[model samples]
Target: MLLNLAIKNFAIVSFVEIDWQQGMTTITGETGAGKSIAIDALSLCLGSRALANTVRPGCAKAELTATFDSSNISKATKWLAKHDLQQDDECIIRRIISIEGRSKAYINGSPVPLAQLKELGQLLINIHGQHDHQLLMKSQEQRRLLDEYADHQELLSSLKFYQSKWRKLNNELTLLQQNSQQRQAQLQLLQYQVKELDQFALQDNEFTQLETDYKRNSNAQQLLLLSQQCIEQLSESNNITEQSSALTQLQKSSEQLSQLAELDSAAAAIASLVNEARIQLEEASKDLNDYQQSIDIDPQKFALIEERYSFAIQLARKHKVAPEELVSFHSNIKKQLNAIANDDSRLDVINDELEQCFSQYLEIANSLHKSRTTAAQQLEQQITNSMRQLNMPDAVFKLAITEKQLNEPANHGIDEIEFLVSMNPGQPVEALAKVASGGELSRISLAIQVILAERIVTPTLIFDEVDVGISGPTAAKVGQQLHKLGHSTQVICVTHLPQVASKGHQQLFVAKLTDGKHTQTKVTELNQPGREREIARLLAGDEVTDSSLANARELLAS
Candidate 1:
């Protein structure tokens, strides 16, 4: 429900604030007295398109703010949470239109895009203009109305779910059918490639181990000669026998120096360093001997390692990957081959799934169609009875529901719904768009809205002069319908009829104010006496006669 509306620098408004309440509220004024201007301000705050000229003269911008009580508006609260906007039970929508034709919109103090503002606005309020009756003439709108009345949201959701599955299956089938020949050729190529790769018997880390073996095999002769040289230098040789070896010489020198250390302490320190060097030399000689013994100097192994390493390099170049990555590459190729070889089986499975999806979609759509048919019949009957009460005694309203041959599955099901009306007896019923007069359309629109009031999700409904071209008992009937609708939700109606105005729980009067230099629009909430005088003016035109006041009082009392 809308809590308050604030307008500033907006088209003769200057500044005005309205605290709205739940139930029916009416705004009335003479023609061109800015009643519609106030409605326009409310519309702008609710994300309507704006113009630069909407800014009052000498003002930089036109600003509007509408506050809504969102304690029960779960859809809007969820939307705010989803968009990460400010979250509160009080939702505020503000719009600013500048003199340069630029517009900015905000929701709950968070700046929002105009599109988002419009989307959120839809959940908060619905405004029906005097021209909105023409919307009833469209087939799509009529279908929507019937669907809303039928309350078939769950069935509609199931239809969408099945339709999506059907589309996915069909897409897969189309791709396979359109490229069957190409896929067959690809299958043969993949099989041959897999066969070639299978011969290599590639293993994880095989390339790395092979490279290591190749390096060892290629340097075997050089390795052996170096090991032999180190052995001769560290141990015995022809020129350096047991005593002449470096290890032997260091140990003998250290023993002699230690004996002299008893006479000098500095000599003892030099002897300890010589002993450590001799120990290291002995360990190196043992390791060199072990390495020489471990060397494998086989010509056949060298040849085999060289051949395997070259094969790996050539294959790596061919596959456009490093030799180390060949294992993963081989696995990927095998997967492709497997998929191609199993294409016929996969295609059969998809065909079965597609058939199943279509069957399910048909089932759900047929059920939805039945519900809509039932709803259309009841809706047509109700509207016909309502139109009669609105002064169309001979009016006949019908909803035509026909099954159309769908080229492809549609989410909305198979029924094509249209509204047909006849204003007089013995006249052929024609489409509402072609046959219904403006007055008849307004009544029909009012009837539909009143019938669907409880079904609509919008918290506030604004009727901007929907009572146009209606008066007397018929106008009273419209007022009574609006009053009935207000009992369930908030409603604001702009009107000139006294019968309609008198039905409001609260009344506001818009009038032009002049200070000789400029004219501005002012809105005043009328007390009981003020309401009586205003309604008397509405009944008596330019003069408030005694008889009009009496009638206004009686109308208010009733």
Candidate 2:
């Protein structure tokens, strides 16, 4: 339910804030007193397209803010989560329009695209406007309305699944049939590619190991020379490397150590280290020889390696991939080979699946059709009954459903449905939104929303001037229905009738005045006597009489 609305710098209105009612709220003013300016503010929050002209003259921007009471926001919360939008217990939707015609929408402090705002707004509130009447003239919209009343979403899902399967099968069959008389060369190439890939027998992560081995073997000679050179320098017999280095130096020092035994006992340990260094040099030399001998540098082996590398490179180039992608390339070729070789069998399998899907779809669709027909009939009967309550005693509503060739998902089936109405007996029923008067259409729209609100989980409904043309007892019935609708879903109706206004659990009055140079709009709640006076004003004209006050008081007290 809309809790409050605030507008600033809108056309003919400088600023206005309205605390709305949960049930049958009414906005009453003399016809041109800017009732529409208030509606325009709500429209902005509803994501209606804005124009620079709507901005007040000399104002840089126009702004609108709406707060919704959200004690039960499960549906809205789930949708917010789905769209990655912020979720809160309250709905604070705001819109800003610049004088240059740019607009922005925000929800719970998060910026949102106008389209998202519009989509989410529909779930929160539905505005019945002149264009909504045009929806009746369109056969497609009529079908959708009936389907919505039927609540047949699951059946539609099954039907769509079947249609998808049929299309897939048809596409496969057509492709194979078109290529059947030829394609032998393509098939042979695929098979050959698959066979070659199998011969290589590629394994995951093996490429890294092969590259490492290749690099090690390619530098084996250099590495062996370096290692052997180190060993030779360590083992040189005549230079410092022999006499001053390692073993030769140690031998000279050990002979001197015995002459100076008291001061040179530590020389033995140094000599031992030199001996170990000589052993290390010997082992290093042997290891180097082993490594050098192990490297396979035969011309035949080199040629084989070169041939394998060239093949890998050429294949990689053909596929526009690196040699390391060989595994993926092999898998792709294998898949293509399977598709080609098993084309006939796969086609048969798909055809069987298509037939099965079609049979299942038809069976369930027929059941769904029967259920929808029953539901539509019941819905039509209920709306027809509601018309009598709204003071149209001889009215009837009809649900018209026809078989249609479908290409996509529908809430129901491949059947087009329409809502037709006749205000009098023995008259042809026309589309509801078309033939009904402004007031009658409002009632019809209200009835449908109220009835469906019991089924659909939408949390809020807004009726914009649905009480425009109705008065007397019929207006009272309409207000009662709205009251009932509000019990289940949050409802806010902009009404002008005292019967309707009096039914509100709350009431707000929209008043406009020009303070010399600028026009301003202000909205405020009416206390008991004040509400009665407002309703009296609606009951009578510009003048409020005692009799009108009595009538207003009676309506409110009742």
Candidate 3:
């Protein structure tokens, strides 16, 4: 239950704190005395959008806070626990809006987003009023309320899981059907690439060897000719034996120098030079003979090297890669070919998987549809009994379920269910919101809310002059219904009828007070005696005559 509400800088309610009780509480005041300010503040605390103008004049910001006792709100407690914002026994929700258009929301002292506040707010309060868009009037809202009462969330969850799976499979099938030609074109390209790679017939290290051999053999003739000249100069001459002739001349010079060595030291030095020159010439002749034997320029082998070099370049250009990538190209093409060849088998497996998913989804959806059909009948009977007690005895009510065609996954079923009604006995049944008179609708809504309070988690309900067009027995019935509903939930109502106010467990009176140029709105909680006096004033205006006071006291006693 909502225990307290505090408002600061909110319209004419500069600062106000209201402590409330669990059962019915009614607020009464003269017109335009700022009674609606309390409702507006409650709305903001429950996550309604706020305007900068809602702040009192001369104030930069407005603040509203509501404290709720969540001992009985299990789901709300769990939600708060998950978010680390649980306040052991009570939850405080606060909203602050600045004149510069900045807004902030908080739950249990933890900052939260406005959207989160809005989502959690519905769990604590519901307000029903005249000239108000009540939730029961809308088909979707009606369905949700019934689902909440019946605890059909698990069934709805299953249905949603199915819908998501069905959509995914449907999307995949469409994509594959539309892109089959594209896949075929890709397969053809892959096949052609594989054939091109096979024809190249590349070998590892073949290009390196071919180029090396070409470079060596390109200068083979020049090397051979150079070696022949060296051989002649050293040891291979036919007419002139070059190395042998040089050796013989050196020996002759050495022998003559040796004969003169005993007579002169300079002749001995000349003999040593001739011996060294003959030894170096002999080694040079041997090296030249080795070079002539090793050079080979075979025409067939040279032709093969040239052709292989040209082929390496051609392969590189055709495949658009360096010579080293020839081996890699072969591996890539083979992999693509394997994928294309096995594609049909893989596609069959995918199709089978999607079929299984689709079947699972349909099965879940059908189960949920059946549960809703059964629950609707039970819910119709319950609401009918409630409305009869709210002074609409002759009214006829029906739960009309029509198959919805929008293809959405509804928790109830693949159908739209409306709360249809006929206010008069002879009239044909029509939509409840359209056919019921204002007063009848008020009573009916109260009855439905009373039934919902047990199932819904919200702790507070606000009725804004819902008994506006009612009086006498009808007004008394509205009071009785509120009294009954209040036993289980806290109800805040703005009312003009003493019949309703007298039945409330608590009463607050809104009045205008003037000080100099300032006009302020004040709300005060009244004790039993004060409440009777206030009701007397409501009945007989400012006079509060003897009969009116006596009647007000009688109402309190009753």
Q: For each candidate, what is the lDDT?
A: 0.87, 0.74, 0.79
lDDT of each residue in 1-558, candidate 1, tens digit only: 999999999988889999998999999998989887868888788778887579999999988998988889888888888898756689989999999889999988988999998888888888889888888878888888899999989999999998888888788888888878998898888777778778977789999999999988789899999999888767766763344766667778888988888788889888888888888888989988998998998899889888888998888899899999988899998998777767767787997887778888888989999999898888899999888877889999999899987656787889998899999899988899899888889999988887787666668889999988888998888888888788889999999999999999989999999899887899989999999999999999989999999999988887
Off by over 4 Å in 2: 6-15, 36-69, 72-126, 156-186, 196-276, 288-332, 335-346, 404-411, 428-443, 446-460, 468-491, 496-506, 527-558
Model 1 regions more than 4 Å off: 8-14, 30-65, 70-123, 241-280, 341-344, 455-458, 471-473, 496-498, 511-522, 529-558
Q: What does candidate 3's lDDT look like per residue over 1-558, in tens digits? A: 888999998887778899999899999988899877888898987778787678888889999999999889887788888888898889999999998878899999989998878777777788876665365688887777667667778878877776776677667667666767787898898788777767767677777777788887888999888878776655444665334545456667678877888789877877777767767877877877777787788989889888878887787888798877777876887886786566655566767766676566556656655776787788778877877877778777788776555343333457677888877779988897788776777777777766777666467889888787778777777788888778878889899998888889999999888787776788999988899898898778889888999999987787
Output the worst ten-in-a-row residue range by lDDT, candidate 3: 404-413
Q: Give one clash count per candidate, in the order shown.
A: 0, 1, 0
Best by lDDT: 1
Candidate 3 lDDT at 428 equals: 88
Question: Which parts of model 3 have CA positions greater than 4 angstroms off?
Answer: 129-137, 181-187, 190-362, 402-412, 426-428, 512-520, 540-544
Candidate 3, pairs of clashing residues: none
| Residue pairs with backbone overlap in model 2 | 240-245
RMSD of each: 4.1, 6.1, 10.2
Question: Which should have the higher TM-score, number 1 or number 3?
Answer: 1
